[model samples]
Target: MRKALALAATLGTLAMTRALMRDRHVPLPTALPGRRETLSAPQVGTVAYYASPEGSGRPILLIHSINAAASAYETRPLYLHYRENRPVYALDLPGFGFSDRSRRRYTPRLMADAIHAVAAEIRARHGGETIDAIALSLSCSYLAKACLARPADYATIGLISPTGFDGRLSGEGPPDGHRGREILRDVLDRPLIGPLLFSGLASKVSIRFFLEKTFGATKIDEGLLDYAYATAHQPGAEHAPYCFIAGHLFPTDSTLLYDRLKLPVWMVHGQRGDFVDYRLAPRFAERPNWRIDSLPTGALPQFERLRAVTDCYDGFLASIRPSSPRG
Candidate 1:
């Protein structure tokens, strides 16, 4: 009895020490370097974003992946690379970066709605010209749903290392219905343990580890890591990330959405890292509106091979003629 009591006391002390050592968090502002904007979505509240000067034809929208440390920073290399040739905009989504990371249930519909709202705003800014859209990983589904809701808003869509193609590849598990990890999400969303668990996952060390894994290299982008750490350290930042961890953000019908896209689609994925199993790509083998490219790196390929990625994207843009401005 004494030994058990002593062990319990030690565990309690460790938990208290950890709680004390946990970083005191305040929200981080927009880390994306450019002209910024704040727009209000009906249900999503205020959204923070960045836009480059308009040039040439229709503007481009870049959506970052959904993850524990997601932000426009994920789209940094692509934004900078494309902004040079055309107008570029990067969104903070609804619960990330400089946006309103309020405590709410982060769902695919909410995220997709956010995308739709931003796309509408961009369309008005560009005199109703349809823009090109690109999304990384899970955002691809949200983007697809947004485009589906209003196909007239987008001219073409690009996806990078998106989910769903490897649904069958992940082996057997759970009753997710292909949408997300509800059981894990339920545990993380709990009041007492949720925040503590998230703080540990969002710590600078943890962020660095994930970033390195994302790049499929021991060395990762230090600047991005810094921004990710800052963003993750923000108050209420863990809400969306926890939702993501629970698979609440990954839409199960993403494959169906991809198949339903009438606009031209350009997809890219790498052969390395944690997210590379797109063996089901052959399913789209006969899709004239769909094109896929393979990279030699991991999930965030643009950071490692910017020139190649831009060149490929440029080729996709070249294939489509910019639509005439709506009368």
Candidate 2:
């Protein structure tokens, strides 16, 4: 009993140390250039987005992936590229950036609604023209749900290194049906220890380590590293990340949404990195509206091979029509 008590005391001491060392105050910088806006959605708090101030063509929406330190910087390359000729916008998901980072139950449906709200804003700004939307990593699922909910709002859909199709297709379920690990959520939300654990995950070393895995190389983007570390240090930053860690943010089934999409779909992925799994992508190869392309870099291919990714994506955009039916 004495030894057990001693072990418990040691663990408690470590937990306290971590909690005490966690909070950081960093001024979050403006991620994109032109202009930023916010829209309130059902369930999702005030959602934030950035867009080109002036452009004269079909607008395109870019959604950054979800991670411990995700922001609009992830889609910087594409945003800048498209901003030259066409209107381009990037979103900072509900809890990640300058949006409402209040501690709440972040879920897939909420994220999809956030996207829907942003799409409505885009439609209002551009004479109600349908949008060309793209998403990286897990945001692809939210995009899918949004498109499924309002197919007419989107002209075409693009997925970059999307999840849910790594090995098999997603199973069918309601939009609210998620794969959240409630037990894990409770554990992570426990007093004191949760914040400490998130701090470690968002630490400089951990961010770079994950970035290396994302780039599949030791040389990662220094700017991204710097921004990620800065954003993770902001107040209330741990809320969404904790939900993600607890699996509350991912959809239970995205394959049905992907299959149901009849609008022109352009899917791109990189050959390198930890996310190079496109085994189930071929199932959609025969679909009349689905177009899949593979790049020669890591998960964040636009960072590694910007020109090539742009060329391929541009071709896909040029080939599609704005009124493409969602049959």
Candidate 3:
């Protein structure tokens, strides 16, 4: 019995040592390559955003997905192309990027509220009562909710590779209550381990591996890998992934809110996107006001096919007009 007990203890120690070693060598991304801007709003956490001052028209608010590599920088291709025609505002959602990280729980409601607060600030600065909002992946849920909560505040809504469309609506219980809730709580409560795991999932090597398997293309832009790595390693970035995995960074069922929304709604998704589910199109199509744009590219359509995505966005914007004149 003593010999068996000693062997088990030795194996446990070895396993722990291996985990610690792997963590120490984990490669993280650097800060996003761009100018950092801060926006302060009442009732919402201080928002960190990236902008290109070289554009015109009603400023467009771009919300990236909640992931380690997710940020306004991830949307750089779109921002660079669209900035000349419209001032682009890409924000690092509350707990991501350089934004506040003190909060322990992030929810779609909280994120939507943050978007509302940021919109208020943008209206104050740009003299516009309403703005065009674009969201990618997980961010789509939060932005959708924000638009639903106050339909008149947003002139148009854009969704890229959106989630939360499992033939359900917003406020519905998440699928796999036990597993999802446990994952959420584990991510939020265990900060250090959560970030490490999330970052590892988003690592360049991991991204490349997944891209090859999903897209059947191994030739990823080296610069993209570098950017992703650097952004994941930023000082507070370690906590951003945890918030995202916890599902507190974005709401899960904003699609159900679609029925109540009256704004021009456009959704774009890559057929081969990582988060793609057959249910997304059919679910959103059930709504009369929503329009869908399917891309032949991958989940990171902006990076995979920049010009095609830009052209699609430009055409969409041209087809719609602000419901009301800006102040």
Number of the predicted model whose TM-score against the real structure is largest: 2
- Ten contiguous residues with the weakest lDDT in model 2: 167-176
Model 3 is weakest, by summed lDDT over 10 consecutive residues, at 171-180
Candidate 2 per-residue C-alpha lDDT over 24-137 given as tens digits, one digit per residue, 9 for 90 to 100: 677788888998888887688788899894878889999999999999999998899889998999989988888889988899888888898899999998999999899998
The residue-by-residue lDDT of candidate 1 on 103-211, one tens digit each, is 8878888888889888998888888988888999888878888888889898888999888789552322332234567678778776657777777887788988888
Q: Looking at model 1, which ten-residue stretch has the lowest summed lDDT?
A: 169-178
TM-score of 1: 0.87
Candidate 1, residue 256: lDDT:
76
In the range 169-261, model 3's lDDT, one tens digit per residue, is 334555212113546666445534554565567667886676554443566556666665655555555555565555455443455555456
Candidate achieving higher lDDT, 1 or 2: 2
lDDT of 1: 0.81
List the candidate 3 regions with Cα displacement exceeding 4 Å.
1-35, 167-171, 174-199, 210-216, 249-252, 286-288, 321-327
Please rank every candidate by TM-score, starting with the best.
Answer: 2, 1, 3
